[model samples]
Target: MNGILIIAHAPLASALRQCALHVFPDAGSALAALDVEAHTPPEQTLEQARQLQQQLGMPHTLVLADLFGATPSNVAAKLVDGIHSRLLTGVNLPMLMRAICYRHESLESLVSRAMMGATQGVVSVAATAPQNQSRRTSHDQDQHDHQQ
Candidate 1:
């Protein structure tokens, strides 16, 4: 199975991992997270990420980062080689959950699934009632008599 790794800003990575764990309690072994603390050296963060990836112990890993050009992504870029692992930016709860759910698939396929989840999860919700149910007005009256 492909392992999943989350590398993001402080607390975000761990929080995303927690969300995945909430949905799939048995995913601890196949998943890991690294929160890049502020002021920490990139080398240190990269090393920490390497350790987490190794601990996953899977043939391939999918690394998810919060932003494309930020510290988390930079560190992750240095960690992935494009063969055994791949990196995807703009990580979200939906993306992470999707990765966890499809971790047993090929690394390339997992990346596609994660990307789809991230993009598809974001949407413009309607302000009106769900399913377009009409709202009741004062003009509406009871049709049945209650007297017994």
Candidate 2:
């Protein structure tokens, strides 16, 4: 299985990891996080990331970062060699959760699934009132309601 590593600015990386774990309690072994602290040098962050990658101990890894050109992403870009691991920016809870769910798949497939989750998870909610919508019938029991 491919392991997942989250690298982002302070708090964001760990926050994403905790959210993923909340839904997947047993996934802790395959997931890791590295929060780059303020004033930390890129070289130091990269070294720390390398340690986390090693601790993940999987044949392949998928690294997620919060921003593309930020310190986290910069460290991750150097951390992955493109053979055993890959990096994806704009890490959101949806993307991390999707990656964890599909960690058993090939790395390439996992990356595709994660991207799909990230894009599909974002939507503009309608402003209609609850009273304006029709109620679900017994036949709709199998359908999942995504709204809160």
Candidate 3:
């Protein structure tokens, strides 16, 4: 099974893991089967990312980071050359969820898809909703309810 490792400064990684679990209740089992590791802590996160790559026997690992130029992103940057990992910044729930579901993909492909998911997730609701140019007064609801 291929592995997906998330590296964030302090609580972001764990918080994302919890959110993923809440979104997909069966993810624990699925994640275990896919060798996904969602870890956080000042000491072990980067090391775990490195070790997971080696253990998975893959030259590359897909690393999703919370912010660019931050500790987590910096740590992930260090592994780029050695482990063939791709570091994606601005990591969010959509990105993490997308990454977990598509962990089997190649590093490049996974990064691309995760980024797309993140971008799409940040849409405005008004833009998505159909525009109703015809304005209705407050009495509209009252009139329908009275007739019923």
In model 2, residue pairs whose N, Cα or C atoms come closer than 3 Å (at least 3 residues apart or on different chains), thus clashing, are none
Which 10 consecutive residues of model 3 have the lowest summed lDDT? Answer: 29-38
Clashes per model (N, Cα, C within 3 A): 0, 0, 0
Q: Assess each prediction's global lDDT (C-alpha) against the native.
A: 0.90, 0.92, 0.64
TM-score of 1: 0.86
lDDT of 2 by residue, 16-45 (tens): 888888899999999999999999999999
How do the residues 44-108 of candidate 3 rate in per-residue lDDT, one tens digit apiece?
65576676556656545666677788667777777666336677878888987887778777767
The local distance difference test score of model 1 is 0.90
Strongest candidate by lDDT: 2
Error of 1 at 48 (Å): 0.4
| Residue 114 in model 3: lDDT | 87
